[model samples]
Target: MEDQREIAYVESVARGWTMEDGEDLSAMRRALREVRARALPMNMSMDLIRRTAEERWSS
Candidate 1:
């Protein structure tokens, strides 16, 4: 269901993205590498992106 959307902005951003696409793949991996540096210190969910999503859309 994640692939389905109703908003134009979301559809616009999602239209052409795919992991198989080689566009900016290296930089994307590097950014993910930086994200992987975050540690699960003292009991925390490894879900920083969910927090980012909530912050982005829960206005």
Candidate 2:
């Protein structure tokens, strides 16, 4: 419930950005890349991560 609302709010905020919006998407991609880089060496499967990323953008 609360988590859904928070996620919705974050998505809304992200959608408000244009290509000119500096650093937001870059920072997110960087953070995600860092996390993926670290997790892959530890054998983490990123299927869910990919799905979440796709779902967010496709929404």
Candidate 3:
């Protein structure tokens, strides 16, 4: 259940949407932090993040 929620949050972020009322901001921030941390190891750029978000939204 938590996994599904996290996925939804990621998809929402990818789609360039803001968090709606009652959404978990902390969790979303944590998720983003985790993504950044992971991406850091790969030397991923902000452009890559934007592209990834666009791709996720399109899919």
Candidate 4:
């Protein structure tokens, strides 16, 4: 049903927006720091990262 689907979507978004799992959020902070560290040194944009990662992964 549409209502059930909407409820599921809202629940998923709520879960992401909240720390119900006792998540420390440090992993995300560390990942962001790593991204900034790499990007700043190379002047990389989001597109560059995506393309580079794709090429590296595919080869």
Candidate 5:
């Protein structure tokens, strides 16, 4: 499973959003960590994940 930091970084990149500095960034990271921890795992293959990511970015 991917860590919170990695998930946050990927989400930021995917949405083309700039990560703010200071306390806001810390809060955001904390929230993401919590959310990720509660999320269910998907039984998908790497190819499917890659394809989905590609499709999302390509749109």
Candidate 6:
């Protein structure tokens, strides 16, 4: 049997978030966009990529 891999499964991975109520959703999406541009080409693991994205959102 071949081993299976799950990609982009949000529940199985750690999420980086600490948003207060009423935060701007557009801002969060912008941050994620920047992080995605940087993280996607680093050849990093998905967990690392997600963590990085979260940091980008907060920062």
Clashes of 5: 0
lDDT of candidates 1 onward, in order: 0.56, 0.56, 0.63, 0.53, 0.65, 0.57
TM-score of each model, in listed order: 0.34, 0.33, 0.34, 0.31, 0.40, 0.32
Q: Rank the candidates by lDDT, best first.
A: 5, 3, 6, 2, 1, 4
Over 4 Å off in model 6, which ranges?
A: 1-23, 42-59
Please provide, for model 4 over 1-59, each residue's C-alpha lDDT reduced to its tens digit, 9 standing for 90 to 100. Answer: 44542111123644644332223345555676898776644545666888889999986
Q: What TM-score does prediction 5 earn?
A: 0.40
Of 2 and 5, the candidate ranking higher by TM-score: 5
Query: Judged by lDDT against the true structure, how good is candidate 3?
Result: 0.63
Clashing pairs in 1: none
Q: Top model by lDDT, which number?
A: 5
Tens-digit lDDT track of model 1 for 1-59:
27753222112554853443344556676677887887464335546667878989898
- Candidate 5 residue-wise lDDT, 1-59, digit = tens: 14444222334444755554557677887888999887656655566788899989876
Give every collision pair in model 6: none
Number of clashes in every candidate structure?
A: 0, 0, 0, 0, 0, 0
CA lDDT for candidate 5: 0.65
Query: Cα deviation in Å at residue 56, candidate 4?
Result: 18
Query: Among these predicted structures, which one has the highest TM-score?
Result: 5
Off by over 4 Å in 1: 1-16, 19-23, 39-43, 46-59
How well does candidate 5 match the true structure, expressed as C-alpha RMSD? 9.7
- Candidate 3: deviation at residue 4, Å? 29
Compose the digit string of candidate 6's lDDT tens values, residues 1-59.
Answer: 14542222123256644443334545666777999887644555777878888999876
